[model samples]
Target chain A: MICMNELQLTVDIYALVITTLTLVNAGAVYMIFYEMFKRFYGAKLKFETPVKNMMTLCGMEVTDEVKHLVPVSEIMVFTFRKAFKHITESLTSEFESKVLRDWFFYALIILTALIVLSLIMGWY
Target chain B: MTDLNLGIVLVSEVLIYPGLMFLVATIIFTQWLWRKIAARLGFRRGPMKTGPAGVLQPMADLLKLLSKEEVRTALSSKRLPALIAPLGIGALSTVLLTTPLAPLPIWSPFDSLVVLYLILWATVSIVILALSTPNPYTNIGVGRYLAFIVAAEPPFFISVLVPIILASRYYSDVNYSIYKTSLYSSSLWGLNPLTATLMLLSAFSGFISMMAVMNIKPFDAAEAETEIYWGIFTEFGGPRLALGMFISFAERVVLPLIYTFLFLGGSSPFTFTDNYLASLITTLIKFFVIFSILAIIDTLMPRFRPDQAVRFLIKYALTTAVIALIASITLTFIY
Candidate 1:
């Protein structure tokens, strides 16, 4: 680790880059995911719970109308089958919204790198 | 100040008097004041336990929230960037250093630009938190929140910037700094017809923008419980809920405090150089006075649709801001 204080401007620039990226990407994904979420969970399933809320909605009778919904009575089976179906049914899995989970991990990688850089710079 | 002393003063400014501690204290105090005002208006008693006149109620609630489980979702919304929520708070607290209320206020050429950006940091931080989780209600709420911000933030920025321009032109101040502009803003009013009119229009424009940005009533469509399920906070619970609430309460503090400095007069009648304590006290009084006015308006006004609020903000707040800006720039050249 270099003990140089000459890189202070670089550090500020690094901080700005990370903050701006985080804000822009978060906002973009939010709007994008919302549009997709609304379209996928369109009019018929508007009131229906998605598979992501499997555990939260455990034991509740599953909607028979929705395609690929493996209607089951057992709580454990319902949770497991729904979780499996959730993964197979979509490209993004949509833990909340499509890409949000991916975005979360993406942001973390950047943040972790920045944190390490700050640590090396002694920017405590 | 020498380098070591300057370091000490800057550190203290960020951590103590005008920074983190001051921010938390303001949150608790302002929360109490707002609740009490609302309760009074509704003919009911606000929190009167936990501390004298329920002053510590907010703290108590915060502690309770802290004790609860930070609910983990399937996604890493709250977990991955846990720092974002606190970072919002940090960004806001940092802005206090730019005001005359600080014992040793900081100044830099065009620091008002930095202050403007810093306040938005708090705002976007909240947006990040809101976007982390997914719910149908949350999405609509966040959409409304974004709409309101898009409509309100520019005018708010311009309104705050008007004072800086007026001060720079009128006072021939050393630099483009919020502190200098604020100190000069108190006297800018009634100096000349142009200045007086500019201040009046700018003040009204700023007040509306502030209310809308803070999600105070009439413009609170984003955060109103009746309108959407907790708006941006639909997914939060436990400690995350506390952090979300802290962001809201802290916002209510910073926006008004800055408005007090830039528009209403930082600490009139008591110059910070002559008496720091008196000036600080005066600043806080004026700060609450503005907050109380907003709260009273919130109590009386009905919630406006997000589209309606956007239209009003564009039509009224932005128009007035432009008029104020032109007036101030013209006045700057005249005198």
Candidate 2:
């Protein structure tokens, strides 16, 4: 007969296995559905529709044909890339001007410093 | 006392102190407080006509609802799940007693894991109950709820592990169950910086995830009243609706209580004293603090779209939880 410790270990192992399997299953299902939706509806629902419509509404010029080539499934990725580029451009300009452009930077710096200090002092 | 007498005592304990009676009382108080505070925040007088600034408002509401006849739609299917859905509140209350809310918890080696599963069970019962009605609105709500669950559950599970890992490290014993771990890890946050940071991050992420799990504002896509007409409860009316409301209220109280026990050092504020009453009071205070935080968040934020809610949980909260888990595991090895 297994002791309490052994039983507990077994339970932990079982839990780990179950959690891993569930995550894997969820990921697989999501990917499958995403691919299916993209393959079936990507071309029809491209720019000049929801995304491009929103962009136009926000006064952004949507004259780029290259954006239309990206599938709806990759819209988030494309948006993230554009956002990152914009942020980098802004940061570079701000740093060149030698002025702290955003209050967020100060907050980040202070938070990071506090965390580092806490780490060094062992005062988590 | 003989075995039968002992059995009766155990049953009474489960049904009385820290059990159904206590839980029902707490739920009533918490529901009233939630409404009163929300009203105050919104600059309105809430439940003033009820007993003593709405302290007994929840009780009065419950009585009114129970006095009404139960109603169901003609298209609804499977009366069993709908009838049984409210019983989830009782199941959760029973599970809460297993937590170390008092000086002496109903201790068991694997009780913490049981709590986790029971929570899942409660949520599943809710989904089942929602689906039982077969209404289009409820179907949409269930779809959103399932999506939130898929995104939230992994990080939540991982965050729960952070404390267990830290506690095992603290005790230098790998075999301690979550209940034992939580009991010993009352002072876990005051430990070294790494663990403290990890615990803090985990708790924060866990709290965010709990907001979604408990269907609070911002993450409350499944119950967006404007969009889906109260979502899952669109078809439920009268007594059954009352039960669903009571269940949600209990969930509001119990989820925070669990978190308080797991992370905020349950009863630790009064650990210097040997009095059980002191421990219980301190624990309740901690619970209220957590509850108030949730309340403020609910008041301030707007509801997220289902996709955005899922994305936030997966992209941000899950990442934090994973980082905390890895850090805790690494620290365990180092210590």
Q: How far is candidate 2 from the true structure (C-alpha RMSD, Å)?
A: 12.9
Query: What is the lDDT, from 0 to 100, of the residue B203 in candidate 2?
Result: 89
Task: Give the local distance difference test score of model 1.
Answer: 0.68
TM-score of each: 0.74, 0.73
lDDT of 2 by residue, A67-120 (tens): 322232243344335434554665687664432645534643554455556545
Of the native A-B interface contacts, what share survives in model 1?
0.00
Kindly report which residue stretches of model 2 are placed more than 4 angstroms away from their true locations once superposed.
A1-124, B102-104, B172-174
Residue B294: error of model 1 in Å? Answer: 1.3
lDDT of 1 by residue, B231-260 (tens): 778667656677778778889999999999
lDDT of 2 by residue, B209-299 (tens): 8888889988887888888777767667545666577667767877788788778888886652366678788889889988887888898
lDDT accuracy of residue B234 in candidate 1: 68
Give the worst 10-residue stretch by lDDT in candidate 2 chain B. Answer: B102-111
lDDT of 1 at B120: 94
lDDT of 1 by residue, A50-98 (tens): 5433212224554322232222123223333443454455445555454
DockQ for every prediction shown: 0.02, 0.04
Model 1 lDDT, residue B101, Cα: 75
